[model samples]
Target: MRIELEYNARSIPPADVARSFVPPTPHFGRLLSRNHTLLLGPRGSGKTTLLKMLTARALNSWTHPEAAALTPQVTFNAAFVAADIAWGKQIEAVGSFDFNASRKDAAFVLHTLRAIVHAMREATELAREGRLTPHAKHLAIEITESQEEKLVALVAPNLSVRPALPSLLGLELALEARLDTINSGEDVAPFTVESFPSKISLLISAFNGVTGDSDRRWALLFDELEIAPTRVKTFLLSGIRSFDERIIVKLALAPYMDDAGFERNPISPHPLHDYHTIQLSYPNKDDARNFGEELFARTFERIGVDAPSLDLLFQPPEGGSQLGRRGNQKRQGVPEEFVSLAQKDTSFAQYVTERNLLSPDYRFNENNIAQDIRKVLPIVVARNYYLRRFDGTHAVANRSRKSHGLYAGYPSIVEITEGNPRAILTCVGPMAQDYRQDIERADGFVQVSRSIQTKAIRRVELLLTSLLQVVPLDLGGFDAGKGLLGFVDTIGRAFEDRLLSRPFTTDYVSTFLIDENVSDAVVKAVGMALNAGAIIHVPYPDGGPDTLLRGLRGQRFRLSYALAARYRLLLTLGDRISLSTLLLVMRGVDVGDDQRALF
Candidate 1:
């Protein structure tokens, strides 16, 4: 029962990953549409995997029954010329081409054209190799030949030696040779930027010919465009706008790329008017949970686990007796078993009483008692919850309090990972391995041990810490400075104070209410933090007004649980904090100070 799963999608080939891929429904629907799309998400949010899934190779390799069933309905019915390019690397490759610094913009356009041609060529090869359906193969050949003819006609005037039409190989060779000649300090006819749009139009026309007039059903799946040179990005965006109806240009971009100054490029058009955007990551609680369930189920099945559901893996032991009756109905309180277990330890008993676990009026008992226990026990038992143990004693503190320890459950783990496929796999893979080991060493339905919970929490904390560390570096371009980190810390402290004080807060906080009078600079910093996944935005109900706080009435923001746990803001998911109080705590603060304390 020792199961091993690949947590890193990059480590596996696209075909292989596609074999086990679980399609994210809404996101997948958007991806399959024939509209120009800009997919925005943080790193590890399955952008690469989604790109792979859209390719001809992945579609052809669909052996899984469920995924295969959907192929004919979407992927099989289309003439998709998918190209998985690491645009960052493409930018680097441009340096090798002979182009003056002043002509960088023109050079970028040429390089992009070359890339599009390369993608078409690669697609044709896949068809030639019989990876695509017979009809798709026929279309691929026609598309390839037509593209070569158009390309040669467009650039033939500048070429030292004109290549024949219908020979893509000759065109590629000639193009490369000419570039090499230019790189070696030889003079060549410069390509004009004015002709760029015409060349792109021809390429789009070739794609259109292959797909036919069937509702303009052709797609170019472009992955990792976030790292492309700014000029290259602008050129691509312009192409997208021009070919809006004829082709679907699907691009996977980092969140910050949206604000990467598209306006600065003369060729770029307004994104709001041109592209349909789909966020690859989950934006709310329900979406996260649904995704997590499917992901966990698939991974478990792959690893040979026979569990019915993900809940089984995290369920508490089952011997808790029902408490007294209330009005002929059960007066829900802590399970008698849990009460008995707590009684064995004086500090735990006090902790239970302080949290009102024995009271019928307690909210925890009204819900699933076992689930409530599972959530609270880990936080209470965390090593940091007590005073420092100089003598290495196991004694617990009399009162329940906030701890400088990472404590979380499966839900929080999913949230912290931010629906990143690799992060989720890696985070849960070890836990599954450990669980299998424990089962082998025990009897039927073994209880998840305290040590396992502790280890899992620590692992999640480490993962989140690694993710958070990248935010500042990534957002450095925004010049938000240390205030960005302070903003994050402010949210974390809010969670922490809630955990320590009475009457816990549960729902998301309003951004406007957090600090109504805060400067626009701080608000922008907060937005950067959101883009970085340091904070999450939970939109106001009905996309309408949020009237919770008086000063700021219609804005929304939610502290990310993963970040809160990483910073020891709160130990468990059940606790809530007051946003108004948190606002006061963060107000008038000089976040730029090097010595600014988080608490």
Candidate 2:
């Protein structure tokens, strides 16, 4: 009856490891040409995760001979440099190291510097080992005098003639590094380092030989790329390109880079343009439905129970009509009940299943959608309004959403990059986590579990946002609630005038004035968000939807305090709210009522 889900990073499978949600680009093998393949996607579209997995797979242990012939494996160690930058400072000092050199001990100093550089880069060691083990807990031995002797002996022949002695021990590192305090936060002093670039070249050369068979000459992953200052970004990009041609680098950028003032980082002969750009799109509606269902089933397993996979749900009948209905005699009502859930469940899975509730053969039109809301009654009606409130950018019906918001700025676009089902699910985990955080930030929310939660004002908003985002052509109006009614004509007018800036367009955005010419399919979807109590609509006891037009600009396009106050009046005015909170009473006052007048 109830389920709980957890985000398990370890369980996430790699996209390149032979999976369905993602496919090796027809041209992925040639990703490392002077022109880099730049993959860009919205948050949770699996861009970063895919990169890590892709790089790993590209360096597979079982090297295919044909693959090797097509593109040579450029073995390189990967490290999250940007992530290091974000961990604050002491860690930043981790990148700093000592390269001491007394003139008499020049050879000895050279070896110590090399060893320290190795130690400084131990972050990649963890990634190399795949997982930590007891053996890796500590470096068994430090650079003793003997080991230093061996290092010097290995390169003795390469040293400059005695007449021209070098001041720095390891000439390679000397060029890029300098010893200085790293500004660590502890009262203790910061670690010093040799800031030379040549040392890295030598180290990468050594690593390339060790893992000669791998794809990335040196796989370096940079997560949280946007957090660094533009200057730092510019510098790092230059560093990777200049010193390491054999190495492959991957960067995890912020979700908003699509809006990343391109003008700021003008695309000229910039190095980043070389990467093959890719954007992560939300899973298709079919994939989303499966992902959601799988998550639900997994949660059930965590609690020591097992149920059907998402595939078990009855498919939406091919036509535009009701596919899953309880009253139908063809199959069990269990499927119908499973497909539809109570609107207020705020958990990640909420009250959703794979069943198709629309009756077969009927054309899906706006009024039909409205009728669906009416049929599902007050529970679905109120929640739909809430779903549209939170996320308004993407279309809501049968589609996956990458970035969500209802601001009327952009048209709905669905472009999917991942083809593997598991990878898609893996990508979604983070986005879902963001939604969960949003729920927590909302006023008076009570997260019951992973799949379910008690709805409050904010949860109601979440419900509405989800609905409005996916369902297109859905606009309506509600005057201060003389009754829970639709503003069909008004929604038509406002939309035609381009009044809805999306999620915040109108308190009764769902009911905004619209022309009757709007598509029926879009209307149906909006009705769903509306029925789910995802939007806020308040019709005056004596007012029409037009009253909302009085407020303009910033004041008009925000959570309506008047509507909230009015909705507040409706809930408390009624009979007791239910176990799962429900708005059963319509907004209005009783006439000719006594002091004991009840809603």
The list of candidate 2 runs beyond 4 A from truth reads 1-76, 85-181, 184-199, 209-216, 236-243, 257-273, 283-308, 311-599
Clashes of each: 2, 121
Error of 2 at 110 (Å): 18
lDDT of 2 by residue, 402-463 (tens): 21211110000010112222332332333334434554577854222222211122332333
Best by TM-score: 1
State each model's CA lDDT, in order. 0.51, 0.31
C-alpha RMSD by candidate, in order: 8.1, 18.3
Per residue, candidate 1 scores C-alpha lDDT tens digits across 287-339 of 76666667866765666555565544653312211111111245445544445
Candidate 1 Cα outliers beyond 4 Å, as residue runs: 1-13, 73-111, 131-166, 169-195, 206-217, 229-240, 257-274, 304-307, 315-416, 439-450, 470-487, 501-528, 541-555, 567-599
Q: Please report the candidate that would top lDDT against the real structure.
A: 1
Q: How far does residue 488 in candidate 1 sit from its true spot (Å)?
A: 2.6
